[model samples]
Target: MVSGKRIADVGYKLFSGSMMLLTVYGGYLCVLRAQRYMQKQKQLQLAAQNESTASETIKD
Candidate 1:
């Protein structure tokens, strides 16, 4: 027969484990978003550079 204390301990462990999993998952999502943001910024910078070069040629 399981005692109430044992049941409570099991519940606590399960809750803590789930929280840890969520924290890791959240970190993963953050990393993915940051990577996407960085990539987009890089693309924008390249586009601006190209545009400036194109304008310079037009002016020449």
Candidate 2:
């Protein structure tokens, strides 16, 4: 049989550990999303540049 104090201690440890893991996972997801957003922005800028250049060429 476990004592009340031991049970409480174990419960607290489990809760805290799970919370830490969740925080780390959330941070990782945020980083991945940020990277994807940056990549998309870069692609959009390149496309715009290409379009401008193509138009300029036609005008020449």
Best by TM-score: 1
Give per-model TM-scores.
0.97, 0.96
lDDT, candidate 1, 1-60, per-residue tens:
999999999999999999999999999999999999999999999999999999999999
lDDT of each: 1.00, 1.00
Give lDDT for model 1. Answer: 1.00
RMSD of model 1 against the true structure: 0.4
Pairs clashing in candidate 1? none
Please give, for residues 1-60, the per-residue lDDT of candidate 2 as tens digits: 999999999999999999999999999999999999999999999999999999999999
Q: lDDT, candidate 1, residue 60?
A: 100
